[model samples]
Target: MNVSGIDIAIQKSERKTVSIFIERDGSVSARVPAKLNDDEIKDILEAKEYQIFKNLAEWTQLNENAVEREYVNGQSFLYLGRNYRLKIVKESSGIVRFFRNTFYLGEKDQPKAKELFIQFYKEKLNSKIHPIIERYKDQLGVAPQQIKVMELQNRWASCTPSGNVNFHWKCAMAPIDVLHYMVVHELAHLIHNNHTQAFWNEVDKILPNYDEQINWLKINGSGMDL
Candidate 1:
């Protein structure tokens, strides 16, 4: 849907209020109440035009530093929020391996470097997030049905009505403190569905310095990619 010269992909769901988001790829999405008609949605979009434009400008500025990486020796990659130089080795038992603060990729795996890196992140994220989830679920007094580390497109993390929490594998590239904030953000959703004050209050209870992590992501997120 294009409203007021802005293109937005509209998603109608069981949600109560309209929410606008600037996706990671610089696309706009609006999640609206399923019952809203096109006219009503248009009106809402028009009303929020200023905010949307402001956010889009910010997204543009932030993504200016987006990283375009190569699968070559001396190229850097992120692991646990730290930069590690990539080394293509002629022989390796695995497609990719991390050792001594560096990423080692088998030369034969060069054709599938992106896939191998994604697999590496997925495996590492699966192992890393479980313990963090366990620690927070008990503190938040909520239990998620399941936790998954997978491709979530533009979102770093999200929670479902059924209590399932999903984290993007790219989150493995964030600093540990920022990763903790992501975990707490999703677990808090099990308690409050929206970003209301009460919902943030719940997050603040667990991570008082959460804003710092949020800012860190805003500044560094565009570079956390293959």
Candidate 2:
């Protein structure tokens, strides 16, 4: 349903309460009770109009900073919050390597550069993620079955029903501190399944300034791409 110049995706479910959230593409979605009629749905949206518009505006502003990258020489890439200039070389060797403030890539590997970078991200995530998880496992009092990094849309990380924590490889692109926030945020989910106040309190206990990391992702996440 398009309301007041904003497009809202309405989903009906057996769930009792109404829930609304903005997507990564700056779109709005609301899950309503399956029995609600169009009129009732409209009323619910009307009642939450203020919140809808507020979040929509924030999404718009945040996505305005989206970055479009090219696999060309002199392009800049982000690794652990630092900017590194790309240096394309004709020599066929490693697909990507970081050295002396530059990210070196093989010119012949241009077509496969994205895949190589994904592997690089997975490598980076594997190196630090487990240690961080171990650091917080005792505090959160929950142990994950495993940690895996993969490509994901719309979320930075998620906790599985079986207690596995999966993170998006793109997460490796963020600052180490921000990455920690993602780890702790997902770890908190092991104890609480929903984003209730208690869940947030758990996150706060692990990272007091988690809101800053969240805001950082809000503003810069669009640029955290291949």
Candidate 3:
């Protein structure tokens, strides 16, 4: 589908709502009910034209900071906001590990090193996020059903309508304090569904330095990828 001179990929399903978003690769997409025709989808996009352009501009600005990382010796990757050099080693066990101030990947596994890094981040997020959530449940008056760490295309984290909170695994690569900011951001959504003044107030009450964290993400988010 095409709208406002931009091509959009429309996916129709049994879903009853219509929503549009920009993808990680800068493509536009719309998810609508299967019965909705192309003209109706175009109308919906037309109605949201302003929001779509705004988000596209923001995405462009964020991608300007994108990092090009090569999987080779001496290539640097982030973990807890610290840079670690890549070191490929010849070993029978194909695995990736952080040791001696370097990230070690078995020579045989270098072809899939990005997957290993993702798994490593998931492990770190699993071990770290639960405690933080527990500490804030009382203060925020919201207890989520579960906290999951996974990959997200265009968001750092999200609080589902069911009260479950999911944080992107890339969040584990951020500084501990920054990661906490992301947790608070999603948790605040458990109270406010949208970004209203009340939501900012709630976030401020918990993390007084939330702006710094927000700025950090705006500047460094593109670098969080593999």
Candidate 4:
């Protein structure tokens, strides 16, 4: 849908309220209640036009430093919010391994470097998230049915209606504190499904400086990709 020269890919879903987001690739997406007609959706978009433009401008500024990483030696990759240079070693024991503040990749696995890195992030995020979840679930008094680390298109993490929490593997590239914020943010969703004041209050009770983490992600998120 085009509204006032802005292009938005709109999706209608079984959601109650309308939500708009600037996607990872810097595209605008709007999710609306499935029952709304096209004219209703267009009116909502027009009303929120100012916010959409502001977010798009911010996205453009932040993405100015977006990194296009290579699979060669000496290229830096992020791990736990730290940049670690890649070392292409001749060893065949594993596809990729991290040690001594550097990532070691098998020469034979160069073609699959992206896949290997994703798998590495997935494993690390899986191991790291559980402890954070355990720490917060008790305090929040919520027990999620399951936790998963997987590919999420436009979110760092999400909580489903079924009480399952899912985190994007790229989250492993964020700082531990940011990881905590992400965990808290999703867990708060278990209590309040929307981003109402009560939901933010729950997160603030846990991580008083949660805004710092949110700022960090807004500034550095573009560079975390492979």
Candidate 5:
């Protein structure tokens, strides 16, 4: 619906949530649970849609602003389960350097700060992810056809019917054990293909503390920044 003449893309899911998003153009889409009937949802769109859209828009903007403020120019982020700040600098020197408790990125070219954040994450943390995966692979005895790292939107990691495993790059943001658990979880799917009891048993046999990783992901593992 148009709040200030913006068009929105609405998405409905089975999960329990009700939210509205303000498009960059000022249009808003009301995201609601699938449990909501068309009539109930229609009433919302017909009445108070503007107010609802505006409020959600404000909240979205505020949250984005906070993230930008915290992540840019001399801000901190949790990486490899530790706190690392983005230290903006003016030197022709290290654009992204890691000290004892901080990550430094040169802001001489501030336009690419986000890109620098990503590059720093990849270069500094990727080497560490493989060893964790190898440890679990040995424990599981079942190996995925292929392991791929990428940015995931809906699911943290996925196992294709072909037995390939693709992990969300953000999994790097999780603790070491948690990353291992995810690798093992996906590897288990390479054998089981579904979330059945035997599948869970396979997981428990190799990763006894799978529940902890599950809880961690639930509490802390998702972001599209939108």
Candidate 6:
């Protein structure tokens, strides 16, 4: 069904025996509830269909321009291409800290604080990876013209044909091996402009488990929200 151009795929929920709900992605599901006749089911579904359609319509209208920065406190956004749960902590001193699951705020919980956190994380990420980048470059006898960390909404790491490599800050969230694979992935782009069998061979040369790392990014990358 179309809810203001947000097409919804209706499905029967095998898990829920009875009831219906809308998914976060605008899909609707109707659970076959026990003791429900065709008329009752139709009534229930019609009611839910209207409600879901209305909600979807409103959201689609509101989010036509979703990329425009709407920095709301406590609302999550992407940072360094990774998602870090943001928690505002009020303290007298101004200090920002990144931990396993959350970021702590010290007397400075503002939108700029978010930017600062991103900057600070970039610093840490650079410290963590710069040496490795240097080592790999030296070993391969192929130096990237430039190395930089970035926030890319589309791709994780991109290397210009000129050998300038830009990495997503979210790469830091991956495991050390996976992170190294990401670096190697970009480096491979220096040799092969597109994904080909030769490209896979180059990646395998540097990283044996590159396929697993790529799969990890696909499955869990969205969870790394800022």
lDDT of 3 by residue, 117-140 (tens): 899889988998888888887899
Give Cα distance to truth, residue 189, candidate 5, Å: 0.9
Every candidate's lDDT: 0.93, 0.87, 0.85, 0.92, 0.64, 0.62
> Which has the higher lDDT value, candidate number 1 or candidate number 5?
1
Candidate 2: stretches off by over 4 Å: 1-7, 10-17, 31-41
Q: Estimate each model's TM-score.
A: 0.94, 0.89, 0.78, 0.92, 0.64, 0.58
- In candidate 5, residue 22 scores what lDDT? 45
TM-score, structure 2 vs. true: 0.89
User: Model 2: how far is 96 from its true place, Å?
Assistant: 1.1
Q: Which stretch of 10 consecutive residues in model 2 shows the poorest summed lDDT? A: 90-99
State the lDDT at 90 in candidate 5: 66
TM-score of 4: 0.92
Descending-lDDT candidate ranking:
1, 4, 2, 3, 5, 6
lDDT of 5 at 108: 71
**Candidate 1 local accuracy as lDDT?**
0.93
Model 4 spans > 4 angstroms off:
11-18, 31-36
Model 1 bad stretches (over 4 Å): 13-17
What's the lDDT of the predicted structure labeled candidate 4? 0.92
Model 5 vs. true fold: TM = 0.64
> RMSD of candidate 6 to the true fold?
14.3
Off by over 4 Å in 6: 1-88, 92-95, 99-102
Question: What tens-digit string does per-residue lDDT give for candidate 1 at 75-122?
Answer: 999888889999999996556899999899988889999999999999
The candidate that wins on TM-score is: 1
Q: After superposition, how far is residue 103 of candidate 4 from its true place, in Å?
A: 0.7
